[model samples]
Target: MSDTRPWIYSTDHDDPDPRTPEPGHVYVQLVGGPLDGQLLDITGYTPEERAHGALLMSNHGLHGPGGRSDYEPRPGAPDRWAGAADTT
Candidate 1:
């Protein structure tokens, strides 16, 4: 099946250091398959989802450079984030 849901790469921050995550910032890879690799001010995720996102970041590292995990967007969610996929 075609995975239309957006994927999250790094929900940490657009900081110079990829190892550190900003306090309240999130880096979403795609929104409805658009705006890839954009840094969003706020995540359009529920409280539980937010927490899960944090865990995903922590467990998989700030950017998950190793392709550890892929986050899918919630159903009927709005696009309010940024981030592009890694080409290399």
Candidate 2:
């Protein structure tokens, strides 16, 4: 998956909001495929994966306490990503 957009986190709601992700929360924008532009929460990734995911985000110029990035959507599986393993 590729990071091509800025990562943003919204801190307005009491509960976890897909529209507004907080620290430790990851929001990825899916690119290409049926789920393109869809925002996904990837907080369920393994610790190692999360670290790598953060690095990927950084490489794409997305930097912040929260893990967020614009990701290239995986083929076939809209909710699955090759870069970030879906443990859930």
Candidate 3:
């Protein structure tokens, strides 16, 4: 099977967001649950809002969505986040 992840074009190529010194966006690595290792781009959320984390719905009305995936800021690792899952 082939990898169908959506974060393939995230940080590698020339990023279009020019807000450098403090870009309007931030990438958090989701480290658990079904969305593990996924890079979530919280561009519109404030710093405090990002810290509170989010309960993202994978595929609400569709099949194989795996329900809501909860993620919070990983302690001591600001760049990474996670849901209720073992291992990092």
TM-score of 2: 0.32
Query: What lDDT does the true structure give each of the candidates?
Result: 0.39, 0.43, 0.63
Report the lDDT tens digits of candidate 1 across residue range 38-87.
34333466766643332222233334444323335444553332222322
What lDDT score goes with residue 38 in model 1?
Answer: 36
lDDT tens readout by residue for model 3, 1-88: 9545545213545666422324565777777666676677777778898888877655422234555666799889977887753221
TM-score of 3: 0.60
TM-score of each: 0.21, 0.32, 0.60
Runs off by more than 4 Å, candidate 3 = 1-24, 59-66, 85-88
Give the C-alpha miss distance for residue 64 in model 1, angstroms.
Answer: 29
Collision pairs in model 1: 36-83, 36-84, 37-83, 37-84, 38-82, 38-83
Instruction: Give the candidate number with the greatest TM-score.
Output: 3
* Ranked by lDDT, top first: 3, 2, 1
How well does candidate 3 match the true structure, expressed as C-alpha RMSD? 7.8
lDDT of 2 by residue, 1-88 (tens): 9654433333334644435455776566554332334455766767655434322332222244343343433555544444432111
Residue 56 shift from truth in candidate 3, angstroms: 0.8
Specify the poorest-scoring 10-residue window by lDDT in model 3.
3-12
